[model samples]
Target: MHGEPADEGQYTVVAKNPVDKVQASAKVSVCTKSKVDKLADVAVNIGENARIQCQYSGIPISTIIWYKDGKLIPTNDQRFVITQETPTLSVLTINNTDMDDKGVYSVKLTNTTGDVEGKVNLTVKPIKPAITRDLDTSYTGTKGEDLILSIAGTDNPYPTCQWVKNNTELTPTTDPRIQFKENKKTNEYFLIIKNATQNHMEEYQAQLINVSGLIKSKKNKITIQKQPTFIKKLQTIRVNQTDTGKMECQIDALPQTRVYF
Candidate 1:
C-alpha cells in the first residue's frame, strides 16, 4: 500500500519461470489531507464590510463553502463575495452589513481526503441611534415654579437631549434658567425650567439626537397659570359732591380669576 509521497516509487516484481523471467512495475502518489487554519473574529460598523479569512492546505484546494448560523449562504448573493488570495487562502467578504448579518460564520474547505472547517464570529455594530418613543405632548405648571419637561426615547448607543422652546433651541448653559438633564437608568431626558412664567407657557419640545439622526418630539404645550395681572390700575373720579363716584380696574389673569370690590 502507498502511504506517502516519499513511499511513492516504482515497485518491480520479478518472477522467474523455467525458461523466462517477467517483471512488472507500478507507481503510486500520496498527498496531504485537507486542513483549515484558524480564523479570527470580525467586527465592523453598519454599512461597512466584514471580511473573514482562513487558509487551507491540501493536494488540490477544493471548493469553499460559507455558512451563517449553520445555514448555507448562497454564493449568488450580491452582498456576499468569495475571493482567493492564494492557492491556500480564501476570504469571505460581506458588504454593507447590518445587524442582521451578525452571527457565527463558518467556511468549509472540501477536498478528496475530507472536509475542514473554520469559524469566525461577525459583530455588526450599530452606527446610528433610533428614536422609539418621543416626549410627552403636554405639560402643566404654575407660574413662579420649577417645571420638568421630560421626553422618553431609545437608541442604539444612547442618545443626547436638547430642549426647544417656542421654536428656539434652548441651550442649558446659555439659556436663562433652563437646565438639561438625562437619566441613563430610565433613558429619560429632561428640560428643567426654573421660575416658569407666562413666557414659558408656549410650545415646548425635546430633541433626542445621536450619531444616526435627530428626532424632535411632538409639540408640548406648557400651560402656565398665573395670578391676576392688572394692566390698568384702579382709577378714582369724584363728580362734584355726591354725584356718582365710579371705580374701575383692568386686569389680566389666567383661567379668568374673579374680581370683587
Candidate 2:
C-alpha cells in the first residue's frame, strides 16, 4: 500500500513476517506441559460441602479432573459435568459422609500438551452429639409409679433418641409394661414405666443417634427400692432408776426395706 505524506504528516512502512514464519522450528522441536493444580488442607464435616480447586500456570489452562485416593471422581458419582466460569475440572461431593470418606485427593490436569498432578488431603471431621436430659438420676418410686424419659441433643439436622435396656432395643408393645411420652413444650422424651417391678430394675441407657453415628449417655440404672415406714408404738416399760414407763419406738416396712440412721 502507498500513502501520500503531507508537509506536516509523518509516514512509515511496516513489514510483516512470512506466512510460514509460525512453522519455523527453534533448533528442532518444543512442547508445552500442563500446569500443576492442587488444593491444600481441605477439610469438611459430615453432611457438609467441599470444593477442590487448582489453577493452571501454562499458557492455556489444562483440563483438570479430581481423584479421590487415586480413583477418578465423577461429576455425578462418575459423570463428567463441566462447570462454567471456574478453572476447576471436577468436584467431589459426599453427602452425610463418615470417617471412611476421608482420604487424599489428586487433581490431574490432562491436555494435548502434557499431564500434571497435584495432591491434597481431605479431612472429614467427626461430629460430636450434644445431649440433654430432664434429670440426671431419680429416686426409687412406689409401685405403679410413672417415670418419664426425656432426652434432647444437638446435631446437624437433629438427633434421634432411643431407650436401650441391657443392650437390647425396646419397642412400644401391647404388654403395657412401658409407656412413651414426648413433651412438645420442652422438646423432651420420656420412658414411663407403669407399675414398677423388680424385673424393670436393670441397667438402662439412652442412646443418641445423629449424622455422625450413635452415642450413648453415661450408663444409668433404675433402682426399684421402696422407702421404709415409721411407726410410733406405745409400750409400758419400767425404767430401772426412774421406776416409770418410758416411750418405745418401732419402724417396719412391708417389703422389709432397710433402715438407715
Q: Please provide TM-scores, in order, for all candidate models, with all chains considered together.
A: 0.52, 0.48
Q: What is the alpha-carbon lDDT for the whole of candidate 2?
A: 0.62
Candidate 2 lands at a TM-score of 0.48
- Candidate 2 C-alpha lDDT tens digits along 1-261: 232222223334454586533332222122347766545667887556665555555534567676788987755552223443465334544555556668887777776667888888878776766675533654455644665555766554345678877788767773368776665555566677877766777666777676678767665677665555557766766678857655766665435665443
Q: Give the TM-score of candidate 1.
A: 0.52
**Relative to the unseen true structure, what is the C-alpha lDDT of residue 239 in candidate 2, on a scale of 0 to 100?**
75
187, model 1: CA deviation in Å? 20
Sliding window of 10 residues with minimal summed lDDT for model 2: 1-10
Candidate 1 on 162-250: residue-level lDDT in tens?
77778788886665788888879888887888988777778988777876678778898889886788889987676888687788888
After superposing candidate 2 on the true structure, give the runs of residues whose Cα lies further than 4 Å from its correct spot: 1-31, 77-84, 87-100, 132-148, 155-195, 198-261
* The candidate that achieves the highest lDDT relative to the unseen native structure: 1
- RMSD of model 1 against the true structure: 10.0
What are the lDDT figures for the candidates, one per model?
0.80, 0.62
